[model samples]
Target: MYSSHIKSVLEEKMWLFQLKYFPFYAEWMLMVLPFIWLITLPYWLPKFIVYLLEGKHLVIKMLILMTISLLTIFLIYMYVILGKPNQEKWKNVIFDQHIKRIAIKIYDATDNMIGGLVNRDVEVNRGIFYVERVPPLYWDVLKFREDKYLEFTNGSTGLVGLLSSPRAFNGIDVIGIPSAILHRRGGGSSLSQQLVKNFYGQDYFRNQTSLNKLNTLLRKYKELDEAKTFYHNLRENDGEEFKRWVAMYSPSLVSAGSVYGIESVAAMVFGKKPKDLSEFEQILLTNMYKYTHYFNGKAHENKCQKIKNGSKIDIKTYFAENPTKVEALIQDIDNWDCTDKPRVPLAFYKSMLAEDTKGQLLIGNPNSRIWDWAGTSMSILRHETEKYKIVYPNHLITEVKITIDTPKNISFKDSVNKAFQNVETKLASRLHVNLDDDAKSEKKQANIWISVVDEKGAIKYIYKRGNTHDKRRIGSISKIFEAIALGNRGDKYDYFYCNEAFQNLHNADGSMGGECQDNSQNNIYSARKVFGASKNLPMMSAFDKYVVKDNKGIHLIKNKIDDEKLQEIYESFNLSRDNNVTLKYELSFGLTNSTPYGLQKSVHKLTHLLYEKQLNYHEAHIMESLKYKIVKESKLINGGEKNSLFLKEIDSKTRKMFDKNTKIYMQTVLKSALDSKFNGTLKGFKSIDGYEPLFMKSGTTDKVVNEKKLTQSKWVAGAIKVKGKRYSLVIMVHSENGIGKKIGHHEIMKPIFKEIVEALNR
Candidate 1:
């Protein structure tokens, strides 16, 4: 019979192991055990009476308590075993207490705080994640190893009682910590740090010093530091941030089958905020958190009774003492709205900020198109709730100060957002409306590219439309190239032969007025005059013979039209510097098509050249790409020796990319552009009133259709200086009805020219 009893005991212990260690809600089953202990309280009374008489009964009872006291010292361990913190019979029990207005003044004081956070423009810049609203009395009553003031210091389980344990709602790991202590246990840790860890999880913590401390005094002070921080947050955020802090701790089942935060639970229980709850209601709520419940009193009645059984204070008469507080709270339940939503004020806050941060964009799109990278998460606000991720904004397009000079007297630096919108709208609306308007217009597609460069050469603003990629011919604009090429030709040639066979344009002459009458004659003209007339035939004729070769008839290919030289030229001109643009079509010298972007970019370079500054493409870019990140990685470089060596190697290559000769040659080409006395090609552009054109060039491409040569495309591109500020412009018009010389200026291109001019002249 003794062996049988031993076998039975072994079986019981194994069953207990499964219930304790396995992932089950066994806390519900074991909650009944606490009630058994309570039932044995009467048994203890008889033993106590016997001990007073014989003393033997006292010895037996003391011995039993000693045997089990080592394993189960804290009241916390008793409830935790059942997979929860409360006995099951009484799921949630409000102690039969003499509930009184103990903190009526405190409750009244916080009411304004609750309202200001929601209704007024309080400083709610920071979001409250979670904090518990534990009154001082609750902390006082925790039965553990007492400190100097008889306050508990978590004697049994301690802070590490629960490790990073996963839980069932809102993805918050239960952390084995009683959710109450995590939030309300407040202070030395910064919100910036805890926010990071709470939202991002414990894995985000590089140094879990908050959890690592073993010394009692040090840990207590550490907790006090966190407490102070949270208290300050309550005052600063008007308690809204702190309320949210309380919410995340124990995401309780406040309604049927749904979990919500402390704020929502308060609104659910008393139709008010935690700050507005009466002392009686506050105590009831705090006790209920020991084992989270679904707002219904029936589901948690056993735990409620268990709470009453363990209380040291007298509460039976206390319940009768304040019927009004209880009655009013129950009346609130009659009109209560049960839902899992943030307090109305916090919900309003997230909504207001949604629109302002949507324009924030991620930088890597390359197209420079705006996208709401923050999305619905409002990641800028949310991301900081954890550690400050260093790479976030850098990963977004970085913001650097850029200066802008606009025709409208607008501050481009301060108002670039408006510029981005207006420029895009004007271009998009023009293209959208005009492309569908005239049946006579066969312009397949069109685009415009405008960019402003600051004094420091930073790109302040850039605007683009369709056809920015494809290479469309820039006809007479090639004159600008010929002029620069000739000026930089490295050979001294006074005159170039203009043959009569060169019929550049229909019924038009590109010859010097000193001699030429018709295309049947041969003439010699100055190289500069060839450029001003956009005398395509003469320019092309002079190009291969005189421009490319010296007066001795030897080819002057100093900077050969090879890969490196051409790339250098393109880079200097800002023409198709990126691989996104192509330059497969060789320079025609006004023979075939070239990109409009290429032409505009060349004019842009001329503007800089006029200012006596230039972007050194080859060397500047190479060093810029390397140097951009140096400021960030300054520590790794140690000293200036390595940086000096890197700079020394690039010094010689960058020396002459924009030397005096190149600048002089470019400036001469720019000056010669407006010298249209010979051809009068650009004189017809009176479209920009009161604004004198500094220099100009026009281009057109023709196609023979039904034996009639109709103009396929027309372009007028140039630079104009107005109000001491310089601006460059490019215009392109395509029409099947003929967009040649007259139509380009009159129909499609002139209005846009006028808009730009008007803004600048204003």
Candidate 2:
């Protein structure tokens, strides 16, 4: 029993081994079957010997038979898989390789064509080009030969690139073997519908529709000339239409070349092809060239017409007529003087002086300076004196009385009260104040005073007591009158008082005289202050500080001026100076005003002397004499035959006057001994070298009037016509206003003396 059990266990182990290793051995043999069959003639072995051998050892024979059967089956499989009895394999291979080669060629050609279109050159790389029937299909990367088609199947469906020789199968014409076998063999889709959509169109396969539409249009047009003309007009009138035309025509031409190649292949097969290029092909080629030429010619013509027509209209005339339009159009052109002057708003003026007393009165000063209000009050007084002289004539005054009080008192009984009464009852009636009688009556009670003076230096009337009230009313009324006067004078004051202030300041003794009052301290402070303060400061810093500081002060004062005459002069020269020039002078003046007020006051007194002389001098006589001297000098310089002799003569006379004026001025200052030396000689002298002038006990008192004649001197003069017409009146101011240690007293007076000479000559 033990022996039987052991034998049974061995048998079970043998069966397990057989089950585990048999299949592996069979598979190994199957793998080598093709090589074995190729090398051995197993099919030719004797069948009788094989049967006899099988009967003698059935189990062994069965195993041998099974191996032989497996080998045979594998051999058959090799023949089915690797062998090519039909030309199908050759045809497929050739077609695939052909498609690959053609695709590469097409890619090279298209790349070159595109490069040419955009003016570029690029090299091509190897790849297959294919069209997919479905969207998102991808092409496979494989080694392609000359006669094989790339085939793929998705599920049960098959696809092939190109076609092999046609063959009949089951009554259906199968152009090539179904791709299912290749697909099952692991081939993949290589091209997708997306590529076609991008390169071609979504309906590219729906052939003849676009072509037919284009052809129909061409047929209806008939003549190429008419078609060209219509296309040209379409391009000119409608860009979308032109784009559509180009799209339709361009593709048709490209496809025509492809169709021609197809036709050539068809002809070789069918044997009845046309001998020459087809009419359609000819039309395609001709239209391609014709359309291109037409497009270029039309573009050239349009450009030419644009230039020619543009030239025909006189730009100068157009500008003259439609200045605003031209300005708007050429707004970006650099350095364009859009108008004769800039149109600044009253608000801008207000903003510029907003920090000063002037701005406060015009718009209300948010940051008021003490000097700003004082200077503005003074300026308004001067302006009012001049204005009343002109308008009231007999009522012109040199002195005014004003009273100041608290706001409550101002609202009650003050100079403002009397002034308001006068304004409402008399001036308001004449000036046309836009206020109701009740409002005027209410305003008349305001706590301010009014005063009047005559041109003879006599106080005509006094309605106020305090200087504070006088200054407040003067500042306020001055500002209001200035606005009214400026408005009546048109935009001239707008430019002069506001815009030209900085520029004028610059031209006036290296100060930006005419810039906006808020641009420099010179505008705010007296000229003496600007010079005094700026003496110690660097040129650049002086200018910058003055512009930032003094400008507000000047603006304050300027806003209070009511003299139309002053505004006229200011506008003519102030707003026209260069920005850089103005900035420099503004800075200089700012520095000058940074010093003590005593120094500033002293300088102003000197300036007052100069100004008084200017105003009192016999201008007509001086101008006439100057004109004569100028003429004489021109003849001496340019000869008697000169056409514009007056110009040179004027220049000569001007120079002489400047030189003489300096000499006279210096002598007067030295002789007066206003310097610290000879203390009693000029009793009121503030200093020996830099002294303030003495004042008489009374305003009308005249200290002395000593006049002296200086020696005559030759001068060079020149003039030029301004704007083809107007004459510019030029005069030089000679004083210690120039560089270096102050010039000799005689030299300082030269220019003034020269002016007197010129006036006498004229």
Candidate 3:
């Protein structure tokens, strides 16, 4: 009895193994069968020729002639098929030798995009998912649901009714094969053929005319030939481990609207990675092979209905608490068999489809650094490709990996967030504005931007709750540049003739306005006092008298010493790449427009120069050596090629813009702007840790509203150094009402700076 049982078990195991490798055996059969039949031709040819010459055994002669003709044609067809090579070269274009996608990846210092180095506010518009190998459940469900004869068939056209219509001998189904041949059409395609069509065929085989049908069959023959090569290649490369990846490349060609590929579909529908898909989800995706964009959920609605509401929970909370319970719940909902016909409500499917169509079905946050880096990397790709004239379909470039050279420390991000929340809460109460209410009117709302960068111009932190890119009348921040321009021209002191109409220049009553309260008497003030106090009229007079050249006694500021020097300064700092810089004599009192990014970059450039001035050759060489050591050790530990640790340095021309003496003098003048008696913008700011202030400046610009002059822009910019590190900071605020209204310095900037100081000190 034991022997008999073992015999049955062995037989069953052998049968299963053959069934699993049926495609391989079938392809070999097609390849080798012609040679086996060739032997019979030699034996039968002589008899057929004699009978035909005698004209006696007509019946026998006809049968032999037909047999010889069929075998000869079959041999010729097999020879032609074997001669063709693989045309599926698109993979080589998209992926490198390691099979990793050939696209630029942005990483933070830690080489991770979604790590805790930044805020978790990323929102991806249409995300893509990538997997090393597809799950077994996916293949099982796909084969059983898509084409039951998938194992036995090569990816070629059906052989039935060959006399009525042309076809390839590909499908090897016991039942469907005869039916397809009798009907003079193909029954279905194997997964390999589906992949071929998805990647290369559909563009040429869309129409179904007779000519198109013949071409399609020819194409199918090539697909079968390529499938044979692919199977061999996959086995030679990695054995059967990556067999499931065969279908991973089959994108939805005709059905899915904008989405393509299994990875993208999985991300779009379930917001899950390919490996994370439940069995039922795999089945549903298998059904999408045919219905794609038009796939209604009615077929599997009943099985998935149990977890419809559960899926709607906030994703953050879903993964945070009782993860085991969530997994069990998902498993229970996915427990249904793929063969069971669903008969449930269609609402769940409809809701998901609605979300997808509206572009609201997201896998990651749009406000994240991931998306920011993605946008930048994509632009880089476009620029590089266009410059070199290398063009390919954009869809082929789907996968990416991001690596940031200097990712922010996670602790730093947490500190920034904590400070930001405190500031928001304080401002909400002080302004009496429901900042959380989406329906609030625009006039009642206020916006703020805080940007920070390292001395090398790499952004370390940014909090943008406003239109930071919108051009704002920069007011007094331009004074920093004016100071540098004057210092460059060797102007030490000498200014007078303060304008009496400085402050109320925009008043609707048409009376000449005033800029500085101290300039009421048109008094002559020293240049140091005028700049330190931000006395608009005296600064204007200094520019007019010493900087501007008299042309026909008009003394135009344009094309003069001040204009040329300021333009040169802007270029050195990369402030205006397009030459949109417009400088006015009233620049110190707000006459030019600049974005937050532009302002931050200018400060960043200055910080670089100041930092470099402190570094001796020995210290600089030691720092470079330390950086190299860190990078090498990281690669040795992490086990892959890492991003280079080289930071871009200031060019020679930019460094030459300010001599050592002039830079030192500029810093001295800027420090006085923060003193209490003059332009005390930093008076409200508190010191943090060992970070000492290097320089500071503030500006306010006015706008006419309801026939009254109102503050439109309030900005403060500065730099600080601590522990051998330098950082540039810019804070900009905008309001429809003046800053003195519901929100003021006490309620907003002061408390915010205080909180930031406390956070950083920790």
TM-score, per-candidate, Cα-based: 0.40, 0.14, 0.52
Candidate 1 local Cα displacement, residue 189, angstroms: 25
Off by over 4 Å in 1: 1-445, 449-463, 490-497, 500-521, 547-585, 589-602, 613-676, 686-694, 703-710, 733-742, 746-750
- In order, what is each prediction's RMSD in angstroms? 18.9, 37.8, 15.5
What is the C-alpha lDDT profile of model 1 across 237-288, one tens digit per residue?
Answer: 3334333444333333333233334444454344555666655555445444
lDDT of 2 by residue, 438-523 (tens): 45332222221222211111211222222222111010001111122223323121122222342223321344433343444333
Better of 1 and 2 by lDDT: 1
Q: Of the candidates numbered 1 and 3, which has the greater TM-score value?
A: 3
Residue-level lDDT tens digits of model 3 in 1-762: 999999999999999999888766665665577667666868976876776657557677678778777678656455434422343442342122212221222234343332111111211211223334576666665655444544422334322222222222232222443365578866455454555555443544656445877877767665555543443333333334224444444443221222344654554455456788875566456555554432234533542343332332322133346677556645644553332111112322332234442232221221232332233233322333233223322222222232223233333334555654565666543442222224444435446666565565444455554445666667667777777766665654332334445544432224343433331433444444555564665455445443221333322122234576666676665553323434545354456667776677677767667556643111100011110011121111111232222344556665666776567667776776556655455555544344677887766766666776555656778787655577677877776555433344434555445544443344
Off by over 4 Å in 2: 1-5, 33-38, 42-75, 78-127, 130-762
lDDT of 1 at 282: 52
